[model samples]
Target: MIGTSEIILIFGIVIFWIPVILLIYLSIRYLINRSKKVHEEKTALDILKERYAKGEITKEEFEEIKKTLDSA
Candidate 1:
């Protein structure tokens, strides 16, 4: 059988430490999700610009895509 002091310590840890640990875990998870969301929020035009800057697309292709984006 557990002693009274041990029972009190266990209860205190259960009531306080559990929530504290959970809060920390949730906060880290939320921050990671938020960062990923920000990265995924890049627009089509932004991607086009990146491709053009990287020389992955020709000037003609860039202009064509830009015109298409503008018409939309």
Candidate 2:
């Protein structure tokens, strides 16, 4: 029952929406990755602070480690 025009229209719609769908997917993925990185950085910083508080590392050592962590 479908004509050539109908087939072309369906293909056209799909082509138009494919990139939009991909873009949305990529954006969500990027945001999730960014948030995860931030969480990991915070966790590392917390652990470093805890170590410093516990006297496991010297002040200079803590400062060096913190600088490395923040840079990453």
Candidate 3:
């Protein structure tokens, strides 16, 4: 009981929504990855600060390592 026009309309709607769905999915994935990276960087910086506080490394060494971590 389906007409040709209805079939074409369904196809058009699917094509239009496919990319929209893909974009939404990709954006969410990118945001999640970015959030994880930021968390990891902050954790590294906190650990570095803790090491400095514990007297494991000198100020100069802490600064140098912090600079390296930030650059990465």
Counted clashes in each candidate structure: 0, 0, 0
Cα lDDT tens digits, model 1, 1-72, are 899999999999899989899999999999999999998998899999999999999999999999999999
Error of 3 at 33 (Å): 0.4
Tens-place lDDT digits, model 2, residues 44-66: 88899999999999999999999
The lDDT per prediction is 0.97, 0.96, 0.95
Model number with the top lDDT:
1
What local lDDT score does residue 42 receive in model 2, on the 0 to 100 scale?
Answer: 57
Error of 3 at 70 (Å): 15
Model 2: residues >4 Å from true position, as ranges?
A: 42-72
**What value does the lDDT take at residue 23 in candidate 1?**
99
Model 1 misplacement above 4 A: 1-5, 8-12
TM-score of each predicted structure versus truth? 0.66, 0.58, 0.59
Clash count (model 2, backbone only): 0
CA shift of 64, model 3, Å: 12
Model 3: residues with Cα > 4 Å off, grouped in runs: 42-72
